[model samples]
Target: MDRVPILKIGDILLVSIQIDMEDQVALQLQEDLAERIVATGCHGVVIDISALDIVDSFVGRTLATIASISRVLDAETVVVGMRPAVAITLVELGLSLPGIRTALNVELGMELLARARDEGVNEDGDAEDEPGTPAVPAP
Candidate 1:
């Protein structure tokens, strides 16, 4: 199986992946990645997908699972560099990654992670459990 590399950018951990292989191989990589991110104790994470070629249900499931685990580890997982085709395919398949954070590229991913680290989650996050929108401080 191909390895997933983790990069630390301040409180954001950027995980570089190249999983264009079969479902088993890809899921294994994602599982290992989740374990490593949890071990790092980072506050935020970005899963870079610049090298990926396709997206399927199993792949979407793996990513969503990893994101859920990362949130538990106090790290927000941002999926970045997703090709337009892949994005459309996931949407068409009705694969909703509700709790997942996304950005266009590594730079933007880091920026969003910083926001999560600074302002915490958006309205879709723990916000609904409470009441009105919480105030956010400038970054």
Candidate 2:
């Protein structure tokens, strides 16, 4: 029944998975993350899995689900710190983990999120301005 810790840094929510992941734990994380995204109005989520040595199909799906939920809440999700073995296992299992962006580490992940925001892009990668908003012509 161990719960993952979700930390808010600036406008981003950082989730570092330090313990073994079980089905119940993953589900709880998904639920908790959704709530945090709404409550904090954060624009990005970074999941650090560097400590984890393995990832099963259920965990992979849970990651994707978390990303989708974050997008729906107007936030972006980035998964970082995936070990090489974990990546191989995921590929071998045919878990493409769609809708999830990855970085080698948290710093890069935050940079990616900042770049997305600076480009006026939403979680869907669409422009964030409304139709009536004035747009500056490209130079």
Candidate 3:
């Protein structure tokens, strides 16, 4: 029944997962995140998983589902702070997380999200120009 907190920073939603997540908790998070994205009209989501040492296949799929849902809602999702062993395990398990974006840490994740937003692009680097808002020209 533990619920992860979702904080808003500018146009991004920050979720720092500090505990070992249960399956139900992960599902709840996905639901809550979708709700938050709709309620806040946020442009991005940064999930900090630095504290999680193990990410099983279920958890990996849940994360991917969350990212896909966020993208459909017009919010990009960035997962950060994966342990090295977890990365290797995920690859070995054939869970490459094809559509989920990632970063080494929260700072870098935030920067990535910000740059994507400023450039009017989605996490996939696709142009998502908002009406009446000019896209920042690439340098």
TM-score of candidate 2 relative to the true fold: 0.84
Q: Give the candidates in order of lDDT, highest first.
A: 2, 3, 1
Residue 109 in model 2: lDDT: 98
Question: After superposition, which runs of candidate 2 have C-alpha atoms over 4 Å from their true positions?
Answer: 121-139
lDDT of 1: 0.75
Per-residue lDDT value at 13 in model 1:
74
For TM-score, candidate 1 versus 2, the one ahead is 2
TM-scores across all candidates? 0.74, 0.84, 0.82
Q: Which of 1 and 2 is ahead in lDDT?
A: 2
Q: What would the per-residue lDDT of candidate 2 be over residues 1-139, giving only the tens digit for each residue?
A: 6999999999999999988778888889999999999999999999999998888887888889999999899898999999999999989989877889999999999999999877754533453455655677999
Worst 10 residues of 2 by lDDT: 121-130
Q: Which stretches of candidate 3 lie over 4 Å from their true place?
A: 121-139
- lDDT, candidate 1, residue 58? 70
**lDDT for each residue of candidate 3 in 21-71, tens digit (9 for 90 to 100):** 788888889999999999999989999888888888878888899999999
Give the higher-lDDT candidate: 2 or 3.
Answer: 2
lDDT of each: 0.75, 0.90, 0.88
Best by TM-score: 2
For candidate 3, list the clashing residue pairs, or say none.
none
Write down the worst ten-residue block by lDDT for model 1: 1-10
